[model samples]
Target: MKKVVELRCGSVDYFGIGAINRFEGIMEQYRKRGITRAGIVTGKNSYRLSGAWDVVKPVLDKTTMEYIHFDGITPNPTVDQIDEAVNLLKDIEPQLIIGIGGGSAIDASKVVAVLLKNTGKTARDIYTGRFKPFEALPTVSINLTHGTGSEVDRYAVATIPEEYDKSGAAADCMYPEYAIDDPGLMLSLPGKEVLYTSLDALNHLVEAATTKLSSPYTVMLAKEGISLIHRWLPRALNDPADLEARYWLLYASVLGGIAIDCAVVHITHPLEHTLSAFRPELEHGFGLTILLPSVIRAIYPAAGRTLSEILKPVVPNLKGTPEEAEEAASALKDWIGGLGVTQGLSDVGFSEDDLPELLKYLRKSQGESGSLSLAPLPVTDELIIRIYRESL
Candidate 1:
């Protein structure tokens, strides 16, 4: 007899090559739900560049609904920025919040919505696990970038500038009420942005599949996401106008997000978070690209078989052998390099002199156990330092 598996995603979702055209329908749903006022959260430029803002503006203009726009968000959003958005949102008291752009903007919108409903609670409280909201203002995530899966999951991330700490926060209320994944909106993304964002999605799949909480269902999603990226990312890069490639990459990112939601991410995420926390200039995906192969090499002894198996779908002609881990890691590194992202930590403005500061942030974020709980190997501080050094 064969075993059975159940798969479900909690949020209402819409995906199509040109699904962005349905934005007006989403607005109608919000109105039907008795939402009279809406808040739109997005980056300063992405929504405009992608023409999403133009499409949205007319919809809002024609409707009776009152709306406010918050476009101050930046990449690697800080807790302080969330507080700023929250302060503004509380004033308008919208019934619904719409998050647009990439992960940073979407994440900011989620945290801001939570703080708005649960007044008097700060982002610091959420980041430190002191305040967990039971309810948040309804949210709709409109994805303009195929990265971070923030559009579909309950997980939201923020950084503390003072402590240089970056962490994830989860609450039942944090999940968006609806997700809009339109590959057409992603067409305007710069080549480097596409590369970095796709890499982030790939990292999400890899980390989710390798985590201890991984199950057959989540692993299947991870493998499919990896395969999609391996096949389409390069093609998307080669021809940005290829709607077919863009559609599949966006689909892969959704799978990656769903996989992480079910299985959680591992060390690579925390390490990259620390790196970006210290060096805010470093894009999250770029940092992951630099560190991924090194981290894979570090953990191969403990998780070689599993890593090898999981990677076979993405790595062509991968043999099911003891050396599979090494081959997979090498292939992945070559792929990343082929995409023209071969920068090391030093190349990105890190030095041995900065190691102590970076280490401090890493220790504070991951704590004594480091990322060992999620990693297959015993991830010691020494090993982490070695990985950083090797990445450099």
Candidate 2:
């Protein structure tokens, strides 16, 4: 086995076959640390549907720790909703906050934790570059979905609806105290969810590996994540009951998260953020599906070699040299179509008429000093417009 040593973030992670069974033990650890009250943040139905709530409730009851359930979070959570959660958290004044669900819930929990401690900083203040908190309430992240890697990372993304912006904040304090990733919880996901969420992980890996900041360690992690997603996502989608497939995909998501934490995601994430920010109803993975192929084509000249290497394990029959960017783009487009996600912007209720407004949002989200600057090539308004039109 290949062995390497690198400095990782401080979050304690627990995984494997029956890792989630240790949920109560983790809660107990917090309780022993003098946590008197706790809050559970999650989505409307995912907490119960994924059976995480069933496992967590008894622990709170048995430990006799006062707890509140904040289940109002939605996909691509808005600034207002996060403020609402923060207000509740302030009222409850929980000693600990546990985020259980997909990326949105976890991210919302992170911001809530930060804003709760930094009473002067509002959600709007954080998003608008007005305030940056240096501390946050202790947090534990329980991941129900295998994508987003929000469990172990220090990134929290939120949409500012009034400004038509979706942005991410990163701080050392944003990292969770513990991240619980249990594949067993993933078995309850619908097939489409399996595909979409896995795709999100795959995108994270690709974007992280291709960014200018990628290092040898991060690249290796990204490659492994891509290979696992390519192999296991289809199987998990075909058979939702397949624990092995779910386990591997969850593993891949963890790798993807780590890779992005080290190297960071580039163009694809910002573009997807624009979509979800405008249409809060858009599933992140679906927006990625529509834009990724075109974005690949646009950036192939600068990112060709990395893209080729990343896709090689996915498409074994892939031909052409690494410099032939179009070859890699073509193969990736075909693979995405094979996964049954061929809808364009038109399919997602977007049209040529929406392009001007979309470009405005894109410019705001992908400003020169923002995440878009990390793209392999300089991302411009003209290029973004072209990519959006192509995706349509």
**Which candidate ranks first by lDDT, i.e. highest?**
2
Tens digits of per-residue lDDT for model 1 on 1-392? 15333354767778987677788898887778788888888889998998788888888777777988888999999999898887776667888899998999999999988888888899999887788788999898989888778898888888998888887887778889888898988899999989999999988888877777767777788778888888899899999998889899999899988887877777788888888988787899889889998888776666665566667755767544556667777887887898888889999888878777877777786331333477877777787788888889
In order, candidate lDDTs are 0.82, 0.83
- TM-score against native, each model: 0.94, 0.95
Q: Tell how far residue 350 is off in model 2, in angstroms.
A: 1.1
Model 2 per-residue lDDT tens digits across residues 1-392: 24333435558888877777788898788878988788778889988888888888888899898987788999999888888887776777888889999999999999899888888678888887778778999899989888889898988889888777888888889999999999988888888789888999998888887777776777788778999998988888788999999999999998888877877778888888888888999998888877888888877788666666677775565433445666666678889899889788888888889888977876765331467887889887888888889898
- What is the Cα-based lDDT of residue 277 in candidate 2? 86
User: How many Å off is the CA of 270 in candidate 1?
Assistant: 0.4
Error of 2 at 343 (Å): 0.8
In model 1, what lDDT does residue 262 have? 76
